[model samples]
Target: MKALAHLNKYLLKYKWYLVLGTVFTIISNLFGILPAQIVRQSLDLVKDTLDVYFAFQGSSLQSGIRDQFYTTIPYFGFLILLMAIMKGVFLFMVRQTIIVMSRHIEFDLKNEIYAKYQELPMRFFKQHNTGDLMARISEDVGKVRMYVGPALMYGINLVVLIVLVISYMLSVSPKLTFYVLLPLPFLSVAIYYVNSVIMKRSEQIQAQLSTLSTDAQETFSGIRVIKTFVQESFFADKFRAGADEFKKRSLKLVKVDSLFYPLVMVLVGLSNVLVIYVGGQEIINGRLTAGNIAEFIIYLNMMTWPVMAIGWTTSQVQRAAASQQRINEFLNEKTEIVSRKKLMTEVKGKLSFRDVRFVYPDSGIVGLDRFNLEVAAGESVAILGTTGSGKSTLANLIVRMYDPEGEIRVDDVPLKDYEVSYIRRQIGYVPQEVFLFSDTIENNVRFGAGELTMEEVEQAVKDADLYDNIQGFPEGFQTRLGERGITLSGGQKQRLSIARAIVRQPKILVLDDSLSAVDTHTENVILNNLSRIMKDKTSVIISHRVSSAKLADKIVVLDEGKIVESGTHESLMNKGGVYFELHEKQLKTEELS
Candidate 1:
């Protein structure tokens, strides 16, 4: 019930529309009640084959005034037509207003959800499935719209219709109305029990849908890998298992849905039987007119939907409740990293770590233990490490990706004091994994770094050694890239990613195994081009190949999360430490080949 309260926040802008639609519904119900009056009067006007008596006074069931009785026939006829017309108009107004409100609300929610996604940290996406997010923003929001629009409008009609019909019923015979309406208390209890069960099942069904979506999205995007490994049949079996599980849950829900409406129909049927039985005996005893019985039967039939609405509206309300809870869970999530300090601007590249230590959250021992490092502004440094060394983790600390236990600072300011966005703005990162968009080469190069002149764009392309390859295409830089840049070779995609980072023109550039995919000749060419253009920019390059590390002023060797060796190439070679050993091993391997 508390979850439904959230709709009030998102729907604040539409309060006027809800009010107007409600007013229309109330006015429309008044018209619906008039038809009963018309029929009662019309029955009284015509002659009756049998006479009937009443203990208390009541009107004719005929549609208009009597031929020779109470009032003018023409006036009653005009009254009947006017009531019917007004009912139609007001019903239209209510529907039109609610429908417009639904579209407006849907559009705004979609935009707001998308904007929230953009602000969320990268780690948030790594923990959640992309498909589950799509279902929440797209499918679950759709479920809420059904309740807010049609179900909400009809719910209003149901209440007003029941009030009007029951008022007339009580006026005619209070004792009978009490008896006829008595079953409702039990029916409401039954519906509430059913609704609780459905809400739980609805939540499970939505979760299963997210699993299915993630499987489909991953399988489709990596279909080529499945083919390359010749594991298509294995993937197909896994997909089939996921689909089968989804089907089993769906069938269980369908059974619940199937039982609901018919159970409601049976309840309505029982109420109808009581009305007919009591009204018929009254007619036989001459206590009720034939027209009065006829009007009551018609009015009772009209009341069926309002009675059904009690059940129908509750089911959708349960669905809306479930959807709201899921959306709230996502919106309420607080990332492990946040900026509680004032923003910092103009970061200089003097970074220091003093007595720093870190362990993975909610888990085991330190990734780095009491590690310390310092570098001067505009310094070019290279880190060489064997597998399992903490090279990348060290780089991550500089940008505040993980919270360390002790002090880490940039330009004498503790890193925590600087805002994450402002720090990241001055730093550019190119990860080991190269991800590219499915768009033109130009867009991939620009990639959200906006409004670059062609000259500025060409400079990054030249620096990454990709300008010649792109110009060779018939479309030049405008050639369309497939999903994940499928049309380009792996080396080309990596270079394109590098070109994108270079375009940002940051003060500190971090390249994590960036040129590993390129040939030795291409790598040499790319490195030479960078040396010319990157004379002013500071860089930290991670490479296992000493050939790539030889140009740096100093090289740091890492092993088992600690610095094992540090010096210039000639000094490290003269010292015969780990770096010189790795360099000699690679040189001998190359000579033997």
Candidate 2:
């Protein structure tokens, strides 16, 4: 129950629905109790009519018996039927209101968790996996819904029925009631012990489920790599191991349930046995009537159901508490990168990084150390670096993916001082690893360009030099792609990514090793097209090849997380430094090709 504390606010939001549903539950259970009372009255009537028939013999007795039986018995039968119908109607309303409200809250909770994912920093995602998060949102939330809905409804009804039925039983005979209720305290103690065990097992089951989901998701996502590397057997063994653990945990949970449920049923049966034995003795001694004994049995059954329900409702509550705890962990995670200040001035695209320092969270590797750079508005700067030389880190910093130690500014204002949304919205970034969704080519290109016309989309495609390829597709721009655009070649995927960024016409455009997958001819054509588009916008091109850096206004060479050289390609070539050696090597490779 404490696990569900996070949902208190949402519960308050839909309190009216819960209140009405609870009222329906109470009314329905009240009607449910009427059938037992009707049985008592019917039995007492039959007993009284029989006594009269036995005492007054002959035709008058026969006539009196027939009239009472035909009139009184049918009336009692009609009452039982009417109460059943009323109870059924109210029970339907209880489900509609309470269960439906749980589904609504489930929806809100899932969306809130998704919103949290969107707000959290990239480091958070790097720490968590897709499947574990998916399980938390889907299966864990479902468990919480069970507690809020059926468990809650049944629990309330159990209390109400117990109180009402006990009061009625006390009226019939306090001594019988005392004997009947003796087992209840022991039953409560047993339920408490079972609930604790259930809570522990339920948490273990959820954790195993998360692990199983992660294994399947990761295997499927990397299926191509598995096949290429011929590691299917390895992955299969791993999956089987995870699945075996899940099965073991589930069986343990079932074992707990098996023990708890029957224990309750047997306890309830014992209560019935005690009532029959003691009440029958009282009847033989002429202290209680036969009809009173019959009525007591009916009330005993009424008490029996709620006592049994105690175990089930408590079990559901325990499982829900486990799930609620998991969900709260995610909901409580602090979003590290939030915009604290608003930018009143519009972006002019002049960018600067001053004494910036950055380190990776996982590996503790310094990505950039005392890095400094300044790019004038509308200037084209090409960054040259080897693997892990902070080129990609620099690009990520511009979009505020990870915060750095020193100041990064745009238009002379600190980047942190500006709104995060505005900073990202103004920049067009094509990352080194191109990712395209499973959608039509038109939608992929116009992803962030809301309300973009088809004409604008086509122009962006043409600028990326991918128009001819799209025209060749079976459905042109309407052609669908596979997951991550796996159907397209690497060069086509990279080109499509470029078209996506260019469609935004952003104030700052970043191409982070975007042209690496294409051949020299296509790369030159794309670069030529980009030169025209970049004339009025600040552009940062990160690439390994010297040919890609030839046309830049300035080129900076990075080595071991520090800038080693900054100059035009021609000046760097004359100096015969690292850039000159890279240029010569590329020229040799071009000659060989």
Candidate 3:
């Protein structure tokens, strides 16, 4: 209930719908209970007329009385029919308002969760998986919807119907009413015990479901890897283990749920038995009429479903609370990255890193330590490093993907002083691991800048040395890609990523080992194209290849999170250091090939 309290805002948001639904629920119950009273009256009238007919004993007026009773019974029947119709109509209205409001809330809640996901920092995503996040927004919200819709509707109906039916029973005979309700306390106790177990088991089931979803998502995403390794059976066994656990948890919950209804029915049956025994004893003592007993029976029957619904409604509410608690976990997360300033600023690409230090929060590994560098507004610098040398770390810092301990400035302004979104917008970044959407080639190229024209897209693709290949496709730019652009070759994917960055036409372009997959010849042609396009833009190219670095105005060599050498390609060769060793090795490998 405390977790469900978070929904008060949404409840208040559609308060009118709730109010109208409640009103309809009460009206429907009133109409529904009215039929019971009509049944009572019809039975009493028949009982009274039959006694009167017996008293007449074939007198002249006996036939008249019999015909009169027959005529009046149809009127009672019509009244009962009309009340039922009215009850049904109001029930429909109840669903229209309450159920529709639940769907609206479901939509709003999903959007809210998605918006929160977008607002969270990269660190949050690193800590959470896609499946767990999906479960909270989809499955958890669905459980909450059940509470808001059917459970709420039936709950209100139950309360109102019980109050109306019990009041009438008490009015007819208080003693019998007391006896009829004697079994309810036991029912309440059972529900309390069962609900506790249900809440615990429901939470376990939901957690297992998230695990299963994650396993499935990972398997599908890495299907190619499984096939390559010929480990399909291994993964299937793992998935089966997860599924079996889920099944066990679900069945445990189902077992509890299975007991709930029968327990409720048994209690209700006890109440009926009490009604018959107590009412029959009262009749034997001449304290109650047959029609009164009949009316009491009608009243108990009317209360039956409402009483049975108590356990179900409580179960739903408990499940909803568990799910809402999970949802609130993510909703309550505060993102570490926040914009200090929101005002837009123009960027001219002058970058400076002063004693920059950074450590990955999740792994506690130092990404950059005492890193210092400077770049003039239009200079193109290539950074050379082996794996884990922190070359990509510099690229990440340039784009503000992660903030470091020391000062970083863009255009002589402190990096943090500028708006985060505005600065990111001006920087074009292509990361080491390229990601492409399952969209057309043209759309993938235009992803960074949605307003790019077809001609601009063509020029960008041509500059990346991918225009010829794209043109060779059957549908050219309109050809759709498979997931993560798996349909394209590795080099094609890299070039397409480059084209995406190029189409942005940003002030600063950072390519983080983006050309690792392409051949040296293609790399040279792409570099030649980039040299022209980035003539007056600040460009930082991070790669291990000397061929890529040799043409740069400045080349930086990094080892173990520190810059070991910095010079032009010729100077580095003269020094015969790390850069020289890399260049020689690559030359030998190419000659051998």
Candidate 4:
């Protein structure tokens, strides 16, 4: 119930719908009570006539009373039928209104989640998985929708049912009502105690299910790697363990389900027995009339639903409450990396870093400690480094992936003050890992760049040295790239990535080790072609090969997360520093091969 308070944003939008739905619910419940009231009075009348037939004591005095009861039975029956029909009509209206609202809520929630994911800093996605995110949007949102719609409606109805039944019982006979309902408060207290446990258990279930989905998704995604290592048995054991854990939690839920209904039934049975035993004695002692006892029995029947409904609604409320906790966690996550004060529209590609420092979130190691560099616009430079030299970290900071605690600027404007979208638009980035979508080759090449003519696409392909290979395909540009372009070779995929970036045509293009797997001949051709293609654009190429870095206007070598030496290929060779050592080492390795 505490977690449900987070629904303020969604509920505020549809306040009128909620009010209208509850109005209809109360109306239906009010009308729903009429049939029980009418039936109770009609049965009481029949009991009066039976008492007269038996010629019980004071029968002569009760003749007119019995006559009046018989006369009014038919009218009560008519009233009962009228209320039943009205209940049906309004119940349908309430169902329609709430269902419509539920659909809108689900749609809005999904959109909000998607929009938030897009607005979140890239680091959020770097640490999460696609399938896990998909599960939240699809599966978790569906749970919230169902809870908001049917569960809420039924819950409101339960409250109304309890109130109406209790009032009718009190009017019938307050003493008998109290005697029969003495256990109800105790039951209410018991349900309240169990509600917390139910909430905790349901939350566990949802989390376990999400983890199971993530495991299955990751297994499928890395099936190739698993096969390469022949780790079928190991993964099978891992999956079995996860499945058993899920089964264990689910069985706990089943145990709760099995216990809850029977407890409600026991309380209801106690109330029924009290009504019959105590009400019958009151009738026998002449303190209560037989007709009154009959009405009391009818009212007792009316209380059954409110009892069961309270329990059912409790279960639903707990589930919904548990679900809100997970959703609120997502909504409240603060990246603290995004700009909130102002939006800067003009962001040029002049990249600069001044005494910058950063540590990865929740980690102690400095990704960029005292990093300092500057690249003027239209200067082609290459960053050479080993795996952990903060090469990619430098590029990520330029795009604001990791917010540096120290100063970094673009076009002389602080990166945080500049609009994120504006800065991203001016720079084209092709990551080390190429991930083409499961779409046509042309669409992947022109992704998010809008429509492109065949000539434009072909020219970009030509510039990336992939034009000839694509032309050889039977479908050519129309060829569908299978999942992540697995249908294409490694070099072809890298070239397609280059083509995609080329289509963006930004002022600064950062290729972060995007060509590490291509053949030597293809790499040479790509490097040669890139020189002419990005003649005026500032290009930041990250590579390990001397052949690739030789084309850059300047080469910057890094070791242990710090810059060691930086200069042109000829100047670096004359200096005989780390760059010269790397060039000679690579040449020796090539000669040995």
TM-score of candidate 1 to 2 decimals: 0.89
Cα lDDT tens digits for candidate 1, 306-388: 77776667767777788878887777776665676856868667767787777655455456767777766677678888765
Q: State in Å the error of residue 366, model 3.
A: 1.1
Q: lDDT of candidate 2?
A: 0.89
- Model 4 Cα lDDT, one tens digit per residue, 144-186: 8877787777777777777777787787678888887788788
lDDT of 4: 0.79
Return whichever of 1 and 3 wins on TM-score: 3
Clashing pairs in 4: none
Q: Evaluate residue 381 in candidate 3 and report its C-alpha lDDT on the 0 to 100 scale.
A: 92
Which of the two, 3 or 4, has more lDDT? Answer: 3
Better of 1 and 3 by lDDT: 3
Better of 2 and 3 by lDDT: 3
lDDT of 3 by residue, 1-593 (tens): 99999888999999999999999998988898777778778887988899999999969999999999989999999998999899999999999999999998999999999999987877788888988988899999999999989999888888878888888888889999999889888888888889999999999989998998899999999999999999999999999999999999989988988887898788778888888898999989988877788788777777778778887899899999999999999999997666666657788889898999989888988888898889999898999999999998898888777788999999998888887778888888999999999999999998958687789999999999999999899999999999999999999999999999988999999999999999989999999999998888899999988888866789999887888999899999999988899999999999998
What would the per-residue lDDT of candidate 2 be over residues 1-593, giving only the tens digit for each residue? 77688989988999988999989988998898788878877887888888777777776668868686889899999999999999999999999988888888988999999999898888888898899999999999999988888888888778777888888888878998899888888887887787789999999999999998999999998999999999999999998999999899999988877776688788778888988899899889887777777777777777666777777788888999999899888889997677768775678799999999999897898999999999999998999989999899999899999999998999899998888887898999999999999999999998887789899999999988999999999899999999989989999999999999989989999999999999999999999999999998999999998888887899999987899999998899899999998988989999999
CA lDDT, candidate 3, residue 222: 99
Off by over 4 Å in 3: 285-287
Q: Candidate 2: where are CA atoms >4 Å away? A: 59-61, 284-287
Worst 10 residues of 4 by lDDT: 340-349
Cα lDDT, all candidates: 0.78, 0.89, 0.90, 0.79
